[model samples]
Target: MAFSVDSTLKELLADERAREVLRKHLGDRSNDPRINMVLYLSLRTIASFPEAGISQEKLKAIDEDLRKL
Candidate 1:
């Protein structure tokens, strides 16, 4: 399935290509144990959290990559 920032973490991560995009930007944090707790959250929602460290520019980049998939 096609992915976007609005897609839930579980939805995006289900696609290997989308997962790679996340891993590329988020690095090891993409695989953190705590990630399980937010599987239902959209990347957009997570990005809204200051602690998530995903800037608007980064979110756009991730969205672009997901669109390419």
Candidate 2:
């Protein structure tokens, strides 16, 4: 029952607001697979918590990679 990224994340991919935000940062790179993967994992991490001030070191790392892409 793993939420496999390829098939289970369709709702995240289909969300207009999510796409809009990613597009703002990524431009053409928004559609890149690596960029999407980081975003997907970041979203999963965020959803794991219910409070504010969550440390996002991993997301920061992902963003650094995103910048390289």
Candidate 3:
């Protein structure tokens, strides 16, 4: 089963430390959907371990995107 952004954010909110960290970055923003999207994409990119034929250039692009978030 896929772990979605809503589910993940729900889980994160349940943890004091996780919630604190998130609040630090997001402040009191009412934009849960956008925040959830950023968190979800960051987690997905970090979880990826691509195989051969996918060049280093592609990997760097992923890294840059994550850093921007």
**lDDT of predicted model 3:** 0.43
Candidate 2 structure quality by residue, lDDT tens digits, 1-69: 222212223444565554444354434354555545444454545434544222455445434443333
lDDT of 1: 0.89
Q: Return the lDDT, model 1, position 52.
A: 90
- In order of appearance, the predictions have TM-scores of 0.89, 0.31, 0.34
| Residue 43, model 1: Cα distance from true site in angstroms | 0.1
Q: How far off is model 1, as Cα RMSD?
A: 1.2
Error of 3 at 21 (Å): 0.4
Tens digits of per-residue lDDT for model 3 on 1-69?
222222355555555654554455435443544555444343334234352223455545433433333
For residues 1-69, what per-residue lDDT tens digits would candidate 1 score against the true structure? 778998999999788888899989888576577889889999999999998999999999999998888
Which should have the higher TM-score, number 2 or number 3? Answer: 3
Each prediction's number of clashing residue pairs:
0, 0, 0
Q: What ordering of candidates by lDDT runs from best to worst?
A: 1, 3, 2
Local distance difference test scores for all models: 0.89, 0.41, 0.43
List the candidate 3 regions with Cα displacement exceeding 4 Å.
Answer: 1-7, 30-69
